[model samples]
Target: MDLSDLKRLGHRSGTGGWGLGGLHETGLEEVRPVGVGGPWAASGTRASDAGEPGNSTAIAALIRDALSADQVVVREVSALTGGAIHAHHAIDLRAEGGTVPGDSAWVIRFPADPSFRIGHPPDVEAAVMRRAARVGVPVPEVLKTGQARAPGSVAMDRPYLIMRRVVGRAVASELVGLGTADGVRVGRRAGEVLGRLHGIAPDAGVVDGLIPPPEDPAGARLANLSRALDATGAVEPGLEWVLAWLTRNRPAPVPPRLVHGDFRSGNLMIDGGSGKARLVAVLDWEFARWSDPHEDLGWLSAPCWRYGRRDRPVGGFADWASFEAGYRAAGGVAIEPARLRFWQVLALLNWAIIALGQAGRFRRDRPETLDLGLTGWRLPELLFEMLRATAPEARAEGADAPPPASDAVVLPAPVPGVEDLLHAVRRALSNGLPAGPEEMGLLINAIGIAERATAAGGMARAGADWGDRARSIRRDGIPAGRSAAHHGRLLAETRARLTLANPRYLIALGLD
Candidate 1:
């Protein structure tokens, strides 16, 4: 789930929207490659030789025992990528004429690290999938769900859930390039599928009480976001401003529904062929919950989730009108424009908090993931979007804010410039090192972190000035003529950040 290669995964071709999609398809179709196995293995090393606990050998043994069949032989295990919270691997095995078929490809999902869990546990995720499937939500079929080390066994330490392999790429970069017509078709289909998902009632024994239902969904989210922001220990003026705006403009509440908390382009599996793309499966139920149905709509339509195709509001692939038509056509509730915007603003704030947490993973949690570290640096764009959505006055008359004070200074690291250093390191990871699938994934993350780090100096300086301006705005109130100037400053700072972190997206969005 390297957010960096989203565009490269899919592309347009004359023979229809379908192309050789997915970086994992170079090895496994559904998942990305795992990082190099050991603490420090050079490129091209095998997982078995890397000496990690989740090495192919240990994983194969764990799978064999979980099946409890003597005839089963685990042949090969390759680490797959694209999961932010879990370590995914494709398990190739021979059943040898047992109840389980022979030469089958299965997936093993295990915790990436014990410290980075925010959703349901493995066992609960399995049960929720089952319940969701019972209600016609298309999910991969779960084969077995178990902890890595069952009570007395001293085997693997992580809990794992196994499922039959399903083909299709969820990476938006790969999906969006499937041609405009194909993109529309996939978007509508996804909207319809999401509507169907939201229509499901949480009456099943398994889903009931799975997670404590928030009595006041919006308030609960705000409270959680407040805590999350506090945990970040960094002052985000945009986040603070948006939180205040949301509090002041609270809308009439609605009943909660089963919501796929993270239902964006990257979480969908698109099966492409003959110039058409169909959503074959919905992935990532980690954030599934009982909440306002509008939350899902807003999340799906959020500017951040749109990836590079901001014009197409629905997951960056289809128009809001078509997506809403598909949703309402599928017997789901109607979209309230104001409510949707409220949730969209909330989604921005939520992602901002999550981004801070991702950065924290590298900073404090010792995950050392490039993905997490880079995510922290991309906050300016999200904050910029928040300013535009919730405080339109900030963009009034297109005026520009005053430049940063002369006192502004950023800690300068030695050697090549940050951007140059990042680009050099990323290039090295991509071509210099021969890495295993696990190592490859880590490399992807490393490149992403480097990409963001390229903007560290600018972001630090801009943030300091932005914080000062925000205080003045709060004290003097957003002045009628000055609001536009403030917005200009926000946009300029955001664009500067994206130039280093995601310059391609800026070019695509015409912001460059």
Candidate 2:
């Protein structure tokens, strides 16, 4: 189902479960649940013969081969949700004559298509985790890692990494549900862990395939954003304004350190089973790189990563003071507020561009799920927030202006209009259906988009000339004495788009 369905099921919409990688930003939905005694119980049948892609039997065999175990019995395997780029499975198995002791639980991470991975290779990720573990960072113990095999190779189809499953919750709803006190505790621990991770010198021979330290980190980031914005082929004046703002306000350079590219709440596994809550393991190392250490802090404190708790700057769990206290306690360098704010703005822009790429994937690859399409709906919200963060003063210029009115027109005579057809489809999908929750959620979201589009007459009614405006801004820069009006126009355009995508979001932000 969509994020709304996930919320209805008592789970928050942003953070995800085990091995979700970047997809943690998008909510997850389960299609079906596998029982304790599922199809993997059968003997003498290969996973391919059973008509499953990554069946339990095949995984057991892979483990056996990787660990050189005498035997491996996969007791159960259940598919975890929130895996758009990679397939994550929680597998419980008993191993004999191997390094692993007794019956243990573990997670298997492998991509369906290895080429689509945006991070380092599986082996590189495992090595990075090993390096982080060396510096007392809490991380999953890598059991086995295998690279992608060539076609016709008698091995696993894709690159895979197996690790001992640390017991904890990674979902944002559960983490935030622990209350402010516990969340602060976890946040302190997270800061300490990040501090330790950042202590690693970039020159250290940690592993291959990591992004090397750039000569100018801030400039490098801006160059990358420029390329990504151009790649999207859609002009975003809000983002263009951000780009210009960043160019004018570049941060001072510092020595590069290892950066956990996606250090935020969902990626942190919190062990709250005990009376006290603490961070157990930091996950999703595929996006790791070498950059300014403050990049991690900025990402952690970004508004979008806070999961609706704007009061707490650090992952919606703890205040900045507590997080900084922990950071200093762990030997982290003194943070500069101006530099931190720069990275924070960069983080929001980066995520907004990534959202556009996700929507592009949905349109080009035609993935089975509606998560990508829904992710695109987040663009307006992100842009609005970006503008607010960078140009808050501009919002006050025309803050009381009336919102754009809907342009939808009603025909005098028609048996079933577009709106009527969309409403009927939405009703039918909402009713009981043969499809599971995941499929039903996709259908529901698709219908919702259509309904919203119909109501707005179309989705592209805002800023038809944004491309031209963006080009002018880039060529000559935002003229002096026109910043407020420029930002006001961008905000209004973004608000219109947000009205179509999610009006409730506008109300929540007090912009409606």
Candidate 3:
């Protein structure tokens, strides 16, 4: 943390800045403290003034004052997770002179940048979550909103939310090797949650600024990719083609409902001890809204959430059979399998772009690190596989699903000399900027792979040859899972790179 960071945090009047690595150190210390938040007070400011820290201090004081007023005695402040959208922390509070209170915890959200997407509009999310909870969803309760808790807390015009904390592991990363029974549970619970959420009716006039539904079904998927790509700053040309094709031939989807715009394994927290993810507390509402319900099913099948075990179905637990069964049990209306594949392809494509945007942010210094950036480099290949898997069905009716409209001609198989088969994967991971330790590991592997590919003159090989290679590997017990992992890395890098690569992105951020 620089003096600028200190100055920027000037919102909470009298509140001191933690400084660069201090904030993270504070977060890490929570697990096993070694002198973190203690009695280290620097009670003076230099003569030369910096307004940044003052802004943060003022906001801090504002919030502390709010807690003071409510007689909620806050003991300490620490960081929390807002998933990929925000950097957040928590506050430990005890009762004071209030009506009802004791030891309780509340989380505080902070956007990666002044304008980055965080959790959600706290007020709205609290309302929806509260309603959803009543509607049979296992969501957390809201204590007091961070915004409402402080007046004039919008120091940088940035938003933060506070909520009651809950428990569970990320269903995506953890439930990979579970059996069909566990898979069925996840699907059932997820379906139950979605059923209730879709059935919700937003408050009157609430659809204020949401993206409108596309003119046609094709338009919807293409629009989704276009918007995601637009945020990513730079997208591989192949994905652009894939987006076009999906859009041009977008199947007629069924009815639109309140879709969990981000439904996937990672967003769900299941109870491992229970042998099932009983606590279906849906996490991350940054993308939640009213949309097509079929998208949810497709989203569940997205390669990004598959946890690298392709054979393992939804949540990497059960196959489509179990997932669809659970969904149908929850009163879900079945759509065509090909349509599901379409959404599945779209889901991976969208994720790749979103990851690209994150990579851009890190590259631009908008985020702490390429925490979720790597995904940008991995999604395209997964999308390609998804498209290929459903190609027969997609083309069954003889419907011409032409590639999406774009002026960029497809490059000579993105991974030069590499077979066309791996072209999509190569295109998805167009570029990246590494920062995290895991990301650095990926970079090391990628460099080695690239070196080997170059030496082997893989570029001379056609797309069909690459397919043969992948098939041969599959025969030898390799799973042929390629894109999501690479895209994950690219997502982190693309966003980080964009801080300098794209003036438009910087302009949108008002940091230009």
Candidate 4:
């Protein structure tokens, strides 16, 4: 199954080194070798291997078994973006040695979950891929597919997938909001790209809820909610109820089109130095299908990809007008605002549930899981704020200041600083203040306020970051990699605050 000679083919074509041109410099070393198992790591070290040569050889055999392709090679695997859970790597192979006419750079994606869920066949991913491609969302042409090679687990675990490597850069985590002109360009381009995707003719639809969940609806609900709370520890109040309302009151579909259900910043990639800034590939087609085109539109506007820009609805590109314009330019029909708004609310609600799952995973000693869990707390609160602002009047009582209810929880002075409530809460958590509902409520309020402050800071922060990111992009080009990653962090933090303020004042009606 070894395909070492595959290196001689064309793997060395302009590979290696930062940004797209010279906008920024990614200090990354190690230009990943093709036909190897790992791309982020050195040439031959497999992320799945533990310094065991024999393990990789066995993996090669497994690849051959899974795919109809002639040969496969496992070199090494490297963790991508936050080095969080999922690991992405390069797999090089050829049809008949180097002599074969056909070839591909296989991407091996695996979960780094310490305890992976089980009870799924190896072909589930393959099946998802096949189904998705049929409806027009792009998937790596599957030469082969697989589940985790659990040697000693009681429950079969750690499902992994291998497919043709996508031709563009990994544009997920970094592509959230437009920060630099490059990001803005990328962000706006992403808008145009997704608009086109929403144009695909209707074929089918999906609602699997990506990560595995308990069989029952409640379990799934709890699982997703826990995930969000654990990751962010915040909530977007009232969004859940509104989404439920929208789900029930859906105004039927305007039209059906191929929808990449999970279309988000991290899922799509753009070719940088190649110019054009056109989306080189549509990815993560596991959620792809034909359905209400507005679903994709809503996902585009989801809080999950806010990249901290609550003001610009579509990945911080501009307003809804720009997004809608771009969509129309890309050939999608103008969708009903009411229907599309329902999906927008629906996207945040979906994310809110998932945030809880993240919290559950990390609340234990899982250090890696902690950040993911932290995200859970943020989105729920943010989404809650969105719903609150959208329907501020929903909470009936006199609109003007009435006597504060004794039960209306608010924290007494514990922190010395006026604005550093988060620091105070952190100190409390560290000192074992035992976070109960009361303490948690105060923490949430404090976070909401801080979030507002940060978002107010974005108008200023954006100016500062533009120079840094632009330098990186210029040094490298649009594929500014880590430069974009840095920007992504800033925006996420800022948008986190914007959601807290419920700025648009839309949630005011909910008070009634």
Number of the top TM-score candidate: 2
For every model shown, what is its TM-score relative to the native structure? Answer: 0.74, 0.79, 0.62, 0.56
Q: What is the lDDT of residue 178 in candidate 1?
A: 61
Give me candidate 1's TM-score against the actual structure: 0.74
* Model 2 weakest 10-residue run by lDDT: 31-40
What lDDT would each prediction earn against the true structure? 0.58, 0.64, 0.45, 0.43
Model 1 gets an lDDT of 0.58
Model 2, position 454, has a per-residue lDDT of: 74
Report backbone clashes per prediction: 15, 1, 84, 102
RMSD of 2: 8.0
Stretches of candidate 1 exceeding 4 Å from the true structure: 1-70, 96-103, 150-155, 204-209, 360-373, 393-397, 400-512
At residue 335, give the lDDT of candidate 3.
Answer: 57
lDDT (tens digit, per residue) of candidate 1 on 1-512: 11121111111111111111111112211211121111111112234321244476566766666665567776666666454345677777887544575677777777665444446676777777777787677788878877676332223467777887787666765654567777778777777877887786655464844765567888777766766566555554556667776776666667777887777776778776747788778777766888888888988888776655667888777877677777777778878888889899988887666556444434443332243344454565676678778656434523565443332222111112244435535554556574456445445544554545543543233355556665665455545555566556555545554455445555555656
TM-score for candidate 4? 0.56
Candidate 4 stretches greater than 4 Å from native? 1-51, 65-87, 93-95, 98-104, 110-138, 147-160, 176-249, 253-258, 273-276, 317-326, 360-369, 379-381, 392-512
* Candidate No. with top lDDT: 2
Q: Please write out the lDDT profile of model 2 over residues 369-422, one tens digit for every residue.
A: 455445656677778778777774545645644443334321111012334335
**What ranges in model 3 sit over 4 Å off?**
1-70, 81-84, 118-120, 146-157, 177-180, 201-218, 227-237, 272-277, 355-376, 390-440, 458-512
